[model samples]
Target chain A: MEGLWALISDDLPALQIAVPLLAATLCVLIRRPTAAWAVAMVVAWSSFANAGVLLHRVLTTGTISYVEGGWPVPWGIELRIDLLNALVLLVVTGICAIVLLAAPRSIDAEIPRDKQYLFYAVYLLCMTGLAGMTVTGDAFNIFVFLEISSLSSYALVSQGRTPRALTAAIQYLVMGTIGGTFILLGIGMLYMVTGTLNIVDLANQLALVGPNRTVMVAAACIAMGVGIKLAVFPLHIWLPNAYTYAPAIVTAFIAATSTKVAYYVLVRFAFSIFRINQTFDGAHSSAIAMMLGIAAMFAGSLVAIYQDDVKRMLAYSSVAQIGYMILGLSFANEYGLTGGLVHLFNHAIMKCGLFLVLACVLLRMGSTRLSAFAGLGRRMPLTFAAFVLGGLSLVGVPLTVGFVSKWYLVLGALEAGLWPVAVLILLSSILALVYIWRVVEVGYFKAPPEGADAITEAPFSMLLPTWILIGSTLVFGVWTSLSVGVASAAARMLIGGGS
Target chain B: MIEWGLYNYWVVIFLMMTGLYVVIARGNLIKKIIGLNIFQVSVIMFYVSMGKVRGGTAPIEAAGFEVYSNPLPHVLMLTAIVVGVATSALALALVVRIKETYGTIEEDEIRRIEADEDAS
Candidate 1:
């Protein structure tokens, strides 16, 4: 067993990507939904296990850098994992595994049986791309993986029941393509000056190059490009519709994982590649990020309150939640960065769990409209109970994952002496409360729609995964050792001990 | 004064702006996709142009060749081109489906149809 483990440990990085990619190809050939689902299940869980092992290795032995095909650094593609990406990898793959466990049932109710195999195939490809993006250390390689995941996502979005899904996917494609091109342009400019595509090499060379016009333009291009992918406020036009119209499983997976990965990229670039002091004429980047975050928080929460469609409401709320993460990042201190990083994990679990609840509701009710949820708390007791827990987490109630992150955020703001920003953080929580209360009021207080007594609880398959996520919100909230500990460590690494 | 020798950049900027303009200005789905392709082509050109070295030959190994054009950007651009084509193909496919279901590919018409659906 020790010998086998030794052999596998060395190649964990490659296997992390290879497993899903190979399994996706196999899924295409299998052509049976159940068989494809089984393939996906095994692949997702194994990748999750792979990420677990990788994270443990990173935590123990420090960063892991694996060169592709036995080439040297600055020439070969590297899959590098430090504390930050390790946490992100675990969040992404772990959420994917749990969501996949609950996916087959919802998928059956929504997608046609004939195309189910294709759906699984594309889903695995999307996972492969996301995992690849998280692991790679090459600049151009990130773009390749970004497109791979994005193309599959566009296809996945179009799989929704209504014709609007097609329009939404197209809009996403256009905006996403422009965003991608801007990134490429930025990388091209970086290469023009630095002459290296490797991230660490670029960072070193950028420091040597100092503040130059070309690098400044490159930084702006990359920021805006990643901002679009991150769905940061003004660039977030494509998100709500895309999430609103996508099939339930696709929405859940993308909502939880994709933005977090994009946030990882932004952080990687902002701090790791271009040090915070060097970006955008020195110190303005943080100011810009803080301003946009505040705007998104207020705007997104206000818009979410008015959305009658529950899924769309959650989508808008996602925009607001992204604000909190960016707000934490803009603080540029240890506590602020830690708050941001932990919120990444916490939000992933909270939002994915909430969406899973909606998926259960969608599977039974055939809609996620506000009216459809009337008296749903009584009819689907287990599912709505899960919803209430997830909702409380969203509102940052005590003893939930949401509050832990917000606490750190508030502390970070106070430490930074940005009292108004701290107050704004608290103010936004009330907005979250208002929107969540709207749903609760409709779900519990209103009478059931006529002849709706036949609705039963979601199948155990769905409820189990939903509760597992909801339960973790409380578990991690109370026991902050793992989540908060790793996050602060990662924060220290990103800030490089200055704080 | 602008250096005319850097004319490749001028062309790149021109194409990029034109492409972006069309993508934003045109309402037809196919036109939008065409604009996207054009925009991608400009980036591809930008990369390819950057690979060129003064007084250099192709990146083939041979005796007496002191300077060779960098081959990496060309290779990376090849990948980008393929991604662009894939995106265009997918966008066009979506347009076809849109036509099939909604019977119009104009953005305004589709929005009108959807708004009506939302209302009723």
Candidate 2:
């Protein structure tokens, strides 16, 4: 019985991916849209519980590596879970459940009734792909699941009524294709240099080879490829449009989960897939990261201030937020990694609440224009209140989730003696405050748009999840232990340091 | 042996850059898709080139065969082709939708429309 339990625990990682995937296919057959949504919600929460328990198990223990059918490394596929993936897995599932719970009423207003059932099904498949990408150790498995998620996301984004959404989806498809292709090329390079599919085996073999030309090329390709996916600075051309034109729920889900998962993959690749000592010596490494982080921070915030649309503004802010995460990694130290990881978790809560609130506003006002939000605080007080809190978090205001991440990041930058970066971070937060306050001012102070009376609150279903996450920003802000605790350990684990 | 050290990689790099340049610089929608196709095919060539071992035959069940071209990159390129094709098909389908909506297939035209819409 004990042995069987261990075997079952070993299978948990794969099941977490496979269960939702199988349910998604079954959901298509359930003709009733309500039933499909019910099934998707249950699956999301179940995955969340599974991920939660798995995270707890790993936190208590250490890394868990389960080879397919009990095969050892270098011979079979592996599902590897350390603190890093476990944390991301929980965030993915948790966000998915919250978004799905709030999806119905939002969809009723924005999406036509006929498309509702299929929407939930596609959402589940996209969630499965994200979970699979997080949980797997095989490089090729990443590509396969990446295509699954990308295809579904295109469908979801283009589901928007605006014809411009089609163009946005096309651009994302084009850029995502190139990104995926470059990753394939990089993985092929690694395979040529080291004849193993298992990540641990590849790492061990790579250490023996050191940094050769092929390995360098692979590193370059992988970095560039994933930089595009995570929407890192200059490579982030596709994100604002995709997020802006996408369906509200789609934006909410992708905002909270998609790019963060890519960041997790980047960490896994940088830390585990290719060990540190071998990687840190790359020429132009620090320069590229620092250059791009500064660019993204300054450019993303400045551009965000010019946006009339709330969703696009938040998307630019995301680019800047990712800059902070990358800046943290540029330090390549324990504290640096901790700051990045903590920010990843904090940004998820803050951004998700912000997007969901935008969804709420869109439901009532039929647009996310800055002008339309004027005096919104009076009409839909709770929804706008959530935005203010979330915005405050985005601007790194004291006692919010964003403040915690920035504080730790500042400490980390100081530890690294990159005082300039510390200054840039502070400056960017002020820039963020400028954009965020622009929205807050319009929402609270400006007079309501003409013919804008009879506006009301987002339905209970929608507001419920929005407030839940908004409340979490406050909860996590004060506690610090949930994000900072996991992030510190996860960061240490990421940089191959003592956990 | 000299051929192995020289032209094998140069050709691959040249072709890859050519493809990438087209994707970045071209304005026509179909041309851009064609450029993407070229970009993908060039990468496949790079992988195939890397997999080649001098004087090696295909890996087949045989006796006393000491050398074989690496089959792994070849295998990966197959999947890459499938993904590439899927992307192309979806992209073209979207272009069709764009043509329907805006009645144009030119990248610059599409941009002008989007800009004009945003300005309004």
The model with the greatest TM-score is 1
Query: What is candidate 1's CAPRI-style docking category based on DockQ?
Result: high
Write one digit per residue (lDDT tens) for candidate 2, span A57-109.
88888888877777776667788888888999999999999999789888888
Model 1 regions more than 4 Å off: A1-4, A278-280, A497-499
User: Against the correct fold, how does model 2 do in TM-score?
Assistant: 0.94
Question: How many backbone collisions does model 1 have?
Answer: 0
After the best TM-score superposition of candidate 1, give how far the Cα of residue A120 lies from its true spot, in angstroms: 0.6
Candidate maximizing lDDT: 1
